[model samples]
Target: MTNLRFREDGSFRVLQMADIQDGPNVLPDTIRLIREAIRKADPDLVVFTGDQIRGYDPAYIDTFLRRRGEEPGARVRAVTEVEAKLRGIKRRARNRVNNRLLAMKSDGSNPDVQQTASTASTTSTLVYSTTSDPQDVPTTLDELMDETRDKVRRTFAGFLGPVIEAEVPFAATYGNHDFQCGILADEQDGIYREFPGCLNPVDSLEPGTFALPIEASDGSGRVAMSVMMVNSGDYAGKPEENDAQYPAYVVNPRGLDLADSDGYGTPSPEAIDWLGAVQSELGERNGDGKPVPAIAFQHIPPQEFYDCLKEVPAWTPNAVEGARTHAGHCYVLNHEICRPGSRLGEAIGCADENVGEVDALREAGGYFALFCGHDHKNAFVGHAHGIDLGYAPTCGFECYGPKSRYRGIRLFEFHESNPAGYVTRMLTWGDLVGRYSSNEVRVWFEDHCVTGAISMRNELRRPQVFAVLSGAMSLGFMAVIRSLVKKR
Candidate 1:
């Protein structure tokens, strides 16, 4: 329902940050990296594409503790630190219980915790008191589920607290893990709606799907670009619902309770239907008879993404170019045009299959490029039948990826004059971390510098080059040996 306007000069910058799972706790490093990217880009719009928090992922703790190396002691000590905190709490509890016990000792009088007591007799009573008064929220199984509603709010607040504080115009789509915390996408949308600039909240009776308009003054009033936001449903659903969209399920040959596909979500049939309805209601793109040039954002990548990858030109290591051109034709879509320029990182595909969703969206033709998140490793751009399939790189320190990995966000610069001809760049974590650590006057260089020098040495020395040096050194050594023999 909300349409963001472009600058009078027809420019809009969007920051696409994906999988910043800095949850259970706020990660200062992750925040620092993101803060730097935001400050550097100073984008007009921010889009967070799911997995903001690692809801109930206990394995993440072990992953974090061992991100650096195989040091068991270091890992154990890290865990012990938590244990130490728990022990401190236990000590407090032990003291509380002991103080009460001691105060009721038959040989003594009431022992005050503060040691400021002079009681009469040994017949003392032990009484327990609460530090916090009990109120509405209690802790039963059902209550815990209910508390998940509130817990998710806190989790999101911590993960996105900085963005909320910055008051940036932003929107979000859900990934499987987003609902792992017990808060549904719709409920979270309500909290986002309360914020200053949250567009396309799917928090309704329907999935949070909205077409945001981006208009610039033609010296008059006219909207130019329309950005569509869609929500891919969650991984956890009823068995019947799960079976309806996917080919395989738990009851298949594997007798498992939860299949791997169970953890994947996609834009539901209803969502695709809704997108079509919205396109019709929104009418022709700026009344040009053609649908307005638009960009769509979602969290889960559809199966069509796998088909798109076949055409992408191979890339070299390190440089990892953000853009690629492909002859777009793998899946059936409403439009069939070559897509150019992509930036790729760790490539991962949808956990579930896309049952005609791509064709359905293609039928609508409301969007030219689609952006997604779910797979944290993949950060590539591919073209499938005229639609730009963009995958934002994993942007969280706490997520499953390399520690020294180039985790960063994707930047999209939409020119009002060329809405479809937007340029994108992968803003690496190194780029932002560089800005942060740039001020240090330390003499030490990057860890790679040592390896770089070694590589250079190897490159500079050929077999012939080594042979010449070896020959000269051997002759000199022979001369030294002769001279020593003669002296002896």
Candidate 2:
């Protein structure tokens, strides 16, 4: 294992990157972003907060196809064909719905139109729900596992190539989606261990929780600061599991639940207890028997985020929608408590359960700040319950994020003399690569359009995209009727 220590100049810099959630066919631009960030930051250590790979993407098939040396254009054409087929199905369904609606306007009592409406709704669901079927995957069970491993390996190597080449020691924790491809979190951890500069511990405090101490720069061999990584789990299986009293959506909007049932899960209670143990262990190691100041990184935000935000009118400026009981309302940083640079572009998708984690961290006595990344667009720091809770924006372009200018990485710089006092800021995509853009139009298109639509192919976004298309069709249909009336 590589040791983490302060530089001889008494400074340490850590780059916190989150949600590189892409499959084996990770986008080239995403790779460019990671490489550019690494080259610019030249961080002493890198921590991937989670969602290293988009586990649900047909990674195995993509890997299988590539290994066969298939032409890239042919592969793109194949996927495009499948999408076209789905789109055709949607078009036919929409036409039927529109025809029925037009007939109903002429004869409101028509039972046939009512039946057709029901059929159209069902067809829409079926078409939108289409996905890579488990039974249709081309490989046997063992072969499937092998392919997944290969996909994960290739994905990691592609994104982390800079870190590996630079020989910067790194560590990672799993996010909800990382294990969806069938490899368990521990297995994924093992894969991470295979790479050079990985600081994942074999003797983990918990399966995905570990600690690394930063040694002082004066060659004193004393622990100067501690960094903790915890794996906040994928989903809360049952309401009782994560202290949740109810499901993610108590009232299903439009009879369609677009949200994950449990939403993103939280670190287990055992993980919270383990935090105290880690602090104690660090104190013992320090030889002073005093708690060492520390910063923690995890994939999901804790419940305390709610305490840090203030609910406001839905139309409130810069307000974002809330989740669970706070749903339908909007929120912004409670400026009374939040630092000036903090921002919230989306709701805090915290788990339903509040496990008193921030309070526990306070009792443990050394934690100064906690950072998480599951809510990709939010990058903020707020003081709540005496500890600072912050978010590191998603660094990967494979998923939804703020526009290119705001989508970026978080940085933390620490000095050995004042390890507890540190400077933190976000290094945006524009900040890193704007100088390289050839022209304003190119930069504007990339920032506003291309970056926003980069995840159009994501399964989660497909339904929303379909809804927008259906609405456009409705508007077009109305326009035709208005033109006919005007001609008459």
Best prediction by TM-score: 2
How large an RMSD does model 2 have?
Answer: 13.8
User: Tens digits of per-residue lDDT for model 2 on 1-488?
Assistant: 77788998999999998988887767776777777888887899999998887654544332221101121111222332354465442111113344334434422345566677767665532111233554442222344456668888888888888889888999999887676555667777888888999999888866568888999988777888988898887665542342232233223211111242455577888898988988888888877778888899998887788888897765454566666756766677888888777877666777777777788889999899999998887888888888888998887766656666677789899998887688989887788876432333543443323211212222122354457777999999999999999999
Q: What is the lDDT of residue 401 in candidate 1?
A: 43
Residue 360 lDDT in candidate 1: 68
Best by lDDT: 2
lDDT of 1 by residue, 1-488 (tens): 45577877788889888888655555666677677778888777888877775643432221111111111111222322354455442111012233333323321334353443333233343222222434422222233334444555665666566676666688777766664444445656776676667775554435456667777746334567777777776553443444443334212312111342354556777777876666665565356555567788878777667654433222222221111121122212112322333433323445445566667668877577888887665666777765788788677765554333356788889998888889888787666675333222221221112222322233223344456778999999999999999999
Q: Which ten contiguous residues of candidate 1 have the minimum total lDDT?
A: 65-74
* TM-score to native of every candidate shown: 0.62, 0.73
- Give the CA lDDT, 0 to 100, for residue 358 in model 1: 68
Stretches off by above 4 angstroms in model 2 are 60-138, 238-260, 435-488
